[model samples]
Target chain A: MQNTPHTPSPETSKQLPELFQLLQPHLKALDAFLETQISEFEPEIRDHVAYSMDTGGKRIRPSLIFFSGWNSEGEIDPNLVKLAAVVETVHLATLVHDDIMDEADIRRNRATVAKKYNNATAVLLGDALFSHAVYLATQFPTTEVCRDIAISMRQVCTGEIMQTMQRGDPNLDMETYFRVIDLKTAELFRVACHLGARLAGFEDDYVKAAGAFGRHLGIAYQIYDDMTDLFSSEEKIGKTLGTDIATGKPTMPLILMRDRLPENEAKALRDTLAGNIEADVPYWLEKLREMGIFEEVRQAIFDEIHKGRNAIRPFQNNPSAAHLHTISELLWNQVAAL
Target chain B: MQNTPHTPSPETSKQLPELFQLLQPHLKALDAFLETQISEFEPEIRDHVAYSMDTGGKRIRPSLIFFSGWNSEGEIDPNLVKLAAVVETVHLATLVHDDIMDEADIRRNRATVAKKYNNATAVLLGDALFSHAVYLATQFPTTEVCRDIAISMRQVCTGEIMQTMQRGDPNLDMETYFRVIDLKTAELFRVACHLGARLAGFEDDYVKAAGAFGRHLGIAYQIYDDMTDLFSSEEKIGKTLGTDIATGKPTMPLILMRDRLPENEAKALRDTLAGNIEADVPYWLEKLREMGIFEEVRQAIFDEIHKGRNAIRPFQNNPSAAHLHTISELLWNQVAAL
Candidate 1:
């Protein structure tokens, strides 16, 4: 399997449906919007924030916001572009703090905000970005958009707090893991679609369908990400791999592996993870592979992707919906390739 | 002179003005509103947020929001109650993070949130509170109120980031000090009044004047706080003192002391401060007193209070406006007694 970056370019996206070409122009516009959105009076903050913005990743969340707003009739509101920028800023803010919490040195093939600057700077930058994003949301004429952003952010914080509390707990159950991912990842995706459809003045049913599509897409995306953490190399992933293991954070693969094994075998894996043997990554990697956990996790990812595909099945005939369907497919393919 | 807590109770507030008595009912309502606002799916978060809210301080910002909305004809919008709650939540969020940054053990005669909980919990709590507050702001029908809250939060972050960047610099000038306070402190205060007046549909001049009032009041309040840090004891203040000195974070007293002393003497003070003689707090305290820096700082506080009073002078003819005027007078009197 070739380890290609998941981030898509105009040329790469050309292989997808015609909707990809439409998305290209909007993604370019989002790039333009994001470039100027980070300016601050403080020179250092301005530069650091700009640096974080410039080291961009796959703009999946913003794409959801744009594509959700693009209905079958091919109508798009200009305001959805700003909403995309706002949601992307929120994502960036979370990444800044997430890096600090994980002590991650690299992200998107560059030093993280915490590593490049300092923890305090990174924390404050995250707060600044959050406030700026809220400011941008309020720039919209309707309170509904701003309200959705705030609620999504609240849910994000709640999920992070729950995840933080569950750290080092080897016995963290599957239910709690699902809840955490739902809040932390799926909530943002849900809100992206919610904001896009709502701002486009779609009916409540369409808006809800859009949200459902994003929620499943996001869940599958996160599950796929967990698989990559277990299977991918640092060179391929461009991040500090195995942090979830090192930090004793219970993710899908570990939970599934422990649950499937015999009681004694599960206990051994748990002890190895909970202990300080995490520095010897290859040993655990070999054990996990020998246990066939990656194969099981790949199946789990496919299961989620199936659910994700089913979520947007109603919108399949809408033409523009193909773009969203392609998103889930591309994410699964990216993970499967790794 | 006698030491008194600046956080007034119903009994103490009754001694000042009839307006305080009117504010009492609203403050109680806000207290009730806050009790229900901290709800999260995670029980630990709900409990921690409630605990932070339980350890109450001077509700000065909420009072500003309430009083600024008190029109001359005795009109008050019920929705302003929610706005007051929103502003107070933002203040609490900042306090939670501020305690972490300062490594403060106590606040409001109780363990600080970071001390009671861990730093991770404290950080997430602050973020949660911020998101909740913004969500509350968006509950308003118009976007103006939400936009004001967002802008105010941005300025607050800007000030904090600037302060964090400038940490351990002994030679921070008065201009920079003023700028930091104006952003970090006065901006929120200004917005509380701005939100209140705007929501109440006050005339443009009245809204502008109300903002000016809160700005000056906040500056005076912060300057008075800086003075107490230099002059008050830990027992009297009910919190850790001399953190600014210990952390080498430049404040008003150090700036004033340096400016007043001869070149060699100023250099010596800076060296003593910039070095790790923070444990010898009494020695620095004695030197500052001998140089009459406390007196100078008190005078500066008075100047700010005077400006604050002048800001609401035109409104004084209104019966409700005298309440705001009395606020500045009482604050000055409180500082003078100290």
Candidate 2:
């Protein structure tokens, strides 16, 4: 591995925010490592596998893995890179499947795997990506990495399943929403941090703390993501917006807005969510702003981020804890800016 | 572990052929073990997981694990049982995904997971099953079982992807058909036997021989399955028959029949397979029967089975070799009967 972190290219840096510059080297290594894995798939589907891997997401999980395992010497641990790749691959596989479920056309400013290839190919290609992720996890010397990954993978799917089952129910409670996000999104984040810290030779207590931090951070990140679907511009986010209500997926803002609406308006909203009536995206987006649900959702995210920071507060002297704090601050800023 | 093999219940015995009676105890243990795994999934999805696990498809892969690990004393090895569960779960997960891609409604005389549940649920449910399988594989003392399983899972997905990609292509050759079947079907069989024999403390040579046997048998089994799709009645097979032709999937019989037809007929057949023209299932079935394609496909299957049997001929002194031989005989008989 290179001793000095590589600089991100201008295009790449522009895609990511300034806060992520510190992870350029680690993410670079992860990209090279993932590229090497393309040949590992069957020759027939290598291109599809490569396409899914190149989605260029924010790499939040990889950042969690890197910062949680930070070394004062600033030498990137190769094991952490591999762990990042494993978690990121799992994340990408979920995205592929998620696109199929959402009937989503675009992701990361390009056609989704489901739109580009077909739903059937997207489904199997996602499975192929998942199998490859587990295969990579097994390359570790011990079973801990694979075991944790398998459990997290299962939880992620379970969370998605719960969300699917609850779709169009309209009365979806905040607890269920939180539970789903915790499983679908936070579970991988927790495992990434836990495994990253453990692999970096951190103490047991610190590892546990890092996991808690990740779990809280994951919850916060997901809320922000859910908010963006209704609030962010399609051009700025590089994807379709206002899909939550359109697809009848009850998110934090929708739930809050529903609760605050007048009885007749709420029934109409419920009817729309239940698919009994057509979804009016503009109406819901206006309601969200009128009800101040956007600021409320942002505050909810801020609270979770603060909880995450408090998790590693006792380890303030540790360099990893400091890095983790900085990363949480970045999330806080993003949410605030939104 | 039971010291004596349990007799299969009459209902199960009737469902399965007489040849599987020797595996009653092992299959029973696997069923119980798999039932216990239902609780391992999230509470919300446990029923769905249980439903998927109880499909009662012929446990050919588990049988391979048991037979290859057979001891003269007939004592069940818990390790082999766990190994069987791992491979079986992976197979079930693949079946769940396969039903979605094939748009298959019924499997093993009942609705497939995809049919019973929505496609999105089926997709995530399949993912959960795959994750659980890897988790089970990681329970072994060493990384070998999990490592081998992960690799096999990737190969299986790759094979399925290749087959999916080849779905409407009239020009798919015999080599690609063999390769797809090898990856999609044969990989799990090979891994089951390989891991089963290795776990049974068999000699290295015997372990390798068992894996070879599994690969050939797997190839033979797939050819037999493809043949049945064209030749069998719905009452006998319990699935929609002649789907390969309708779906434009070029299997062994279709490939053979296409090659043997005269120029004009062959062009028409090619057009049908390419979706340029509607498939005439009755005509193709008639062609398959008249062209001696059924007998040729049977011969192809027999060749694979014979090769499989020959792989373990040198290890006849080992009881496992005899048991493995008996399993091959079962496949041989099934093909002959077909």
Candidate 3:
């Protein structure tokens, strides 16, 4: 069912500006880490890849990875940073390929690899990232961590597949949507914390705690993404938003909103989506807003952030705890922005 | 430049046939091993993946892996067998995906995954197989082995990217072609043998020996494939074999054949390839046969096998020594079939 979008409170939004500042250095480290890993292959591979990667994004994934690792509270090795970068690269891989699968033309306010270099290059680049992620996965000290990371990869791929399958299916259920997001987006967040805990030599409960933290956070973040695209306009949101709705993505907000509609009105929304609308996005955009999906998803985002923050309660006292707190707060701040 | 088609022959191919056949049982055992390792996940994951895996192929990659483990004379753990099967699965992952990339309709006399289900299903199935392999990889006795196998995954993907880049480009060099094949097709073979030796408690020298054997054999196999695709009809080859000639792939036999062609004739062959002249397949086929490419590549296959056999001489006394011979026999037999 549709949940309303989470609009940010002015106070929370201002509070996390410092978190973005904190992420700047981590982003730099991540950029270098990414370059070095790609460099292991011929330079051309990295250059082609880095060109697309250099486009700016929020870098939320790496930040999550960092929080997970740094919170482990033991001697952190350079390997953790690499692993953090690995998490980001894996995300980048999914983004690059996902752009192609979705036939998306714009990402991060610029032409996607598929748009810039052509689909073949985008496909190859996506493959390279997948390859390189696995390549970089080896540096961890134990095979257990590496294996943990590897398992997460399957989840990511499976999630993407599920998303693709449900893509234009108006009848797509809410439960399947959550399962897809958990596997596709949240699993990495879960694994990132788990690996971070293991690398820090944290014991069993700590690992579980980190995993739960990342999983919930990731789910919250994705839900927020779904919410924003439906509720916010490009100018107001400060980016090109709402393509998900136009593409028949049947995101949570729309699902919830549709549930509240009269049967005829609901069927109209499905029919609109079933047309597989892509062009003149604003036309479909107006339809969804009229259908009350925007408010519904917005509220859902708020609830998710509330739940996500709750998941990290167990790790509050740990040294890396602040970063974890900051990451979640930054997410909450996004909801507050909505 | 275009080169004429030349089929490889078993009499002149690299590895031994009987050994490849012997490794078949081991390969089957490895598949069984994957089943055991896969059990912790939901049964749906394994059974869905098994749908494609159980259909099977010649078991080329795992055979190399089993021999690699055997090469070291280490205790045979079912783990190594499982590892070998997973490697084969990785190769399968590439094949299924590559078929999609190439828009191929068939693989091994059966409809390809993409053809059988659809692009979406095939992509997911390939990913599922990949993830399943990674999941099974966790069961290996050592993390080090896992790391090595993971690296092999990178090589496969990179090889694929490199090969894709070369597609439809007549300017691709023999050196570039070889490099692509080594990465795309041969790296797995190298790992197959290297893993065998490493698992069996073999030292660095043994690792090197097996690596050497796999590399040479893989190269020969690749070259043999090139030649057969050019010379054999699709009906006889059991696949739509002429993409190399069709897409202007600069494979070895073509490169060598081009060298032997007169300026005008070479120009004409290049013309046919650039045109993807399916109707004139016989015209190019005749041209390749007349240019003595059959003899040149046949000689090259003999050299690769000679080299492959020679590299394994140090392990001649190992229990898997017959395995190495069988691999060489299998390879040569493939050439002989051509």
Top-lDDT structure, candidate number: 2
Model 3: lDDT of residue A237? 77
Residue A49 error for model 1, in Å?
2.8
Clashing pairs in 1: none
What is candidate 1's lDDT per residue for A1-338, written digit by digit as tens? 12133333222222455656778778888888888776643553678679778766888888898877875655445697899989999999888878877778988778998899877777777887888899899888779888888888988888898988888787889988988888989999989987787887777877787788788778878888777787888887766677677778788888987788899877766776676444455666777889888877777666665665555565555543566666665776676687
B1-338, model 1: which lDDT tens digit per residue?
Answer: 22132433222222466667777887888888887786642564687778878866789998888877876645445687899988998889888878877778888778998888677777777888888899998888888888888888888878888888788776889999998898889999999887787777777887888898889888888888777887887887765677667767788998988888899777766776676343466776788889888877887777776676566666655444566666666786788788
lDDT by residue for model 2 (A1-338), tens: 11111222111212235537767888899889989999998888989988888887888899899988988875778999999999999999999999999898988778999999999889988888888888888889999999999999999999999999898998999999999999999999899989989999999989999999999999999999889899987877766678778778999999998998999999999998999999888988888898899988988887787777777777876778878877776677677677
Query: Which one is best on DockQ?
Result: 2
Q: Which parts of model 2 have CA positions greater than 4 angstroms off? A: A1-19, A233-235, A238-241, B1-19, B239-241
Q: What is the DockQ of candidate 3?
A: 0.41
lDDT of 3 by residue, A233-307 (tens): 578877667666567788887677567778986777777566643345565567667876655565565566555
**DockQ-superior candidate, 1 or 2:** 2
- Candidate 3 DockQ category? acceptable
The sequence of per-residue lDDT tens digits that candidate 2 reaches over residues B51-128 is 998887788899999989988877789999999999999999999998998788988878998899899999999999
Question: Per-candidate TM vs. native?
Answer: 0.90, 0.93, 0.88
| TM-score, cand. 3 vs. native | 0.88
Model 3 superposed RMSD (Cα) = 5.1
lDDT of 3 by residue, B181-206 (tens): 88777788888888777877777887
